[model samples]
Target: MGWISHLCLMNMKRRKTRTFLTILGVVIGVISVVTLLAVGIGVRQEMINTMIDSESICQIRVTGATGGKHKDRMILDQTVKAFQELDDVDSVYPFYELYVTLTNGKYSYDGVITGIPQSELTKKNYTKTSRRTTSNVKPVLVMGDKTASLFYNPDTDQTYDTAEKKKAESWIGKKMDLSFWDSQDSTSVRLEVGAVIDSGEDTYNRDSQSVYCDLDVLKSFLGRLPGGGTVYGQPLDANGNPYKDFVYSGAVVTVDDIDHVDAAVKKLQDMGYTTENEKEYLDTIQKYLKMIQLLLGGIGAIALVVAVIGISNTMTTSVFDRINEIGVLKVLGCDPDELQILFLTEAGIIGAAGGVAGVLLSYGFKGIVDKIAVKMFDLAKGTQIAMIPWELAAGAVVGAILLAICAGYFPARFASKLQPLDAVRNR
Candidate 1:
């Protein structure tokens, strides 16, 4: 096989110009296939990055069932403890939310106040735009940027403009009146703003009207409002006496890894809690990206198909040129299997050369595409339009070699079947 392979390579060099042209066809085909698939890879990565830029994909939102005295369905201190004990679970952040009206000078905002742990603030992308979040022990509220937009002076600016930004900038280190209500009654609490945050922009305006405070501070004022101490709409021991343990309206569970989210959600469901699995969004993204990759790969395969035709043509011509040599080899007791393998090996060598060149050039092409996107569309420097992972490159090379061998099959077979006596015929 080694001698046969060497012979095939030597024969390939005899028709240097023809071989070069055929290899060039394969190179172009490989480049098209790799670059197109790379686009799919790049775009898929972009969507995932956008989704989890400041949020963890391994998180699940858990809430208590509505209208029930069921202890199993409620999110309580015990519930948090149980969630923490789950396998692969990282930590739990339980919080209670209350409707509140915030007032800052002449501006006022109607929003929900979340009482969450200080450690979970940064994990939820609650970065301080007003001041550095040095201490979480303070009894202060962190307002969202959009919430501050409503707190800007009506006379100064009605929209979130430059003036509104300046006004929001001053919203830090100020006091606001936080008023909340229950199904039975309502109350008010005054709290100081610790900082304002940029919770990233979105069309849904999820953070447009939200504020955060420490869990202890929230519990301190919960007793002031009617039904504040209630757990899942059920009062303590049916006696109207406040429960010693604090009740969380909702909680978020963080898994050690995204793959563990499904199992964690299942366990939470079994515990009688309503859960929202963030992994569903990721699964959907994966499905869509797989479809996109297939579509792009199919489109690129058309070019490779044309290159396969070129290989078949080259192999057929080579067989015709080497008809005398084929007859001489057959007469010397060369096996037909070896003859076929020789042609196939030669075709594979051509494919290998072209695939290597194409993969290398694909990297250069990726850089060029990224630069063009940055310059033409004003995309961020970090933005990319193409990505050739090792798997994709290796797959492309293997695919090219197989396709070349397939193309050379008929020519190799024709060469192997030639009669030794017919080789010298002048007809």
Candidate 2:
């Protein structure tokens, strides 16, 4: 080691208790902040994963204004064509939802039905068969996994059991009677069950508890006729006027890349349409996470500030105790810069030691937290509730050392400027 470093070490060794206590203060500060920030990052990531899936991240929902002059803007085919022309848009699919009653000979179900483009539905693993039907038979429809359980056998007066639930999967190839109330008139049609789709584990799936069909088929049954004549079986409204133009409930705009989802949402909002996207939700969540981290960092800063004060006091006391020693060194031609360097090195060693120990302790603490999370919260396997990146570890150590050096700055400067004779007399 260099002579200055050796001297610095010997000085620290002379007051082992003081050095240990000061370092302990810094360690406590670092560990507290690191652990808190780690938890924040972990929770943020887990929430994003749980609440948002790939389908949600890449799609934006647009709905028309209700009870306004421009309420019909989002329902036109021209709007769909315009969305398709947007720079990042991949496709625009019409969205329709309506309450309907479904019945087999022995069972009946009442639920909402949704209509989407068959090609888009297939891409999301909605069904095993991807082929579009060409036959002129009954229109085929897909059923949600939960929609099957909504059926009750009125003849047997029973709901589906475990075994019967499994049998409901075979309903994909059967025929069913579909009926719905269009205003005051009721309409019924025979639909061929093409598939029963599992909507996965998300809390809300557009297909869950709903039947899926081609957009045109659903419109023909539930929407105003092409000639503006009748809506399903309803010939006129309560006022005896022809029905209004058919309008889609909403539109799903698929973006070519997730990075462009926010920009696309902004454009849609500018057109006065209501918009929803997971990206916007995630941005709001991230803001809250940042605030939480800032609060935690402030708490840790208090401890670190106390540690800095302790370090300053210790160095000042050392300068006074070593007045005679410093005088002797000056008499032997020691430079003022060298004297400052020696004292600063001693303080840095203390902070560096604390920082490293703090990092190790933080990791150990993280392991304990993850264990508790797994046991109590039933967090998914391999999900980390505390994440410490390498950047954080390195930053903690470097930051601690710099803080210690700064705390010792005035003390080191005072000692360096002391006159040899005055220091010897004071000692």
Candidate 3:
């Protein structure tokens, strides 16, 4: 080791108790900063992860601009096709939701059915135990994984209990009776379940407890025939003609990337359609997180500022006590710069030691806090409410070292400028 480092070590060793006290103050400050900042980071990350996992980040929900005044201004085919052609528009799916009663044998469930374009439904979106041969007769269907679970016969716990693991194999190919109110009439339709999908890990996945079918099939069930003239008792227009065109309750436009959501929403709004994007909610959440981080960091900075003052005071006292030593060094023709460096090095060592201890203690404290948070908030096990990035850890250590050097600068300067004779005589 160099003389400056060696001398710093010796000085700290000689005044172990005093050095330890100084390091302790820094340690407390670092711990406070790391832990508080970590909490803010952790909360922000959790919220973002939730949005991503729930598949809400890139999906934009667009509805009619007329509110409830004109229900028939439903999103039409040409408009959907136009939206699909837009830049960054990966895909567009028309949504039509209706509260329906699904029945099979003695079991029945009141649920919502959402109709989406059959051609756009990707195989990766669902799992089919047995792929049914394409036939014009059966109306193909995909049911949510949770929705399939409701079909299990509670009387016999055999196949139904284990069906979830098989990806709802028992329900595949079975015809289900669906009943819903279409305007003034109560309508029913029988559809076949072609596949069952894993809607996500969350219990409240939108598809859970719901069925998905071709948009055309759903429209037909509602008495709106595709080819024309109110055959299934569809509502007539003012001209006493059946509405042949398909009308969507809403349209879900997915952007190619999350960053492009604002652009897509803006374009849709300019076209006179009301839209809602989860990114808006995410933006609000991010602002709140920034505020929280600032509040936490400010609280911790106050502690660090106090520690800096303590370090400055300790170095000043050390300079006074080492007056005779400084005089001997000056007599030996030790450079003024070297004297200043030695004192600064000593402070840096104390800060480094404290910073390392504080970081380790912060991690341990984080573990305890996470455990308490999980239990108190009923969060999933292993969920950490405080997260400390490597950048923060390294920065904290480096910051402490720099702060110490700055704090000790004036004291070191005073010691370096001391005259050999005066220092010796004063001592």
Q: Which one is best on lDDT?
A: 3
| Sliding window of 10 residues with minimal summed lDDT for model 1 | 129-138
Query: 122-191 in candidate 2: lDDT tens per residue?
Result: 6545544424431233447777766656788876777553327554456766678887744444546777
What digit string (tens of lDDT, one per residue) describes model 3 on residues 1-427?
Answer: 2988887888878888888889999999999999999999999998888887755689889887323334345477777888899999998878876666777765566666777766755532665544662334444677777665565455765333254454454678888787654434455567777777766555555565567777666665555433344543233456666556655667999898888999999999887788988789899999989999999999998898888888999899999989999999999989999999999998898889988999999999899989999999889999989999999999999999999889999999999999999999987
Order of candidates by lDDT, top first?
Answer: 3, 2, 1
Question: What overall lDDT, based on C-alpha atoms, would model 3 receive against the true structure?
Answer: 0.78
Clashes of each: 0, 0, 0
Which residue window of length 10 is worst by lDDT in model 3? 65-74
TM-scores for every predicted model: 0.79, 0.78, 0.73
RMSD in angstroms, all models? 4.7, 5.0, 5.8
lDDT of 1 at 284: 94
Stretches off by above 4 angstroms in model 3 are 65-74, 98-113, 118-202, 208-214, 224-244, 375-384
lDDT for each residue of candidate 1 in 46-155, tens digit (9 for 90 to 100): 87776665345777989984333565676788888888999999889898877666666566666577878867665444445435443433357776666655554568
In candidate 2, the residue pairs with backbone N, CA or C atoms under 3 Å apart (3 or more residues apart, or in different chains) clash, namely none
Q: Is candidate 2 or candidate 3 better by TM-score?
A: 2
Q: What is the C-alpha lDDT of each candidate?
A: 0.76, 0.77, 0.78
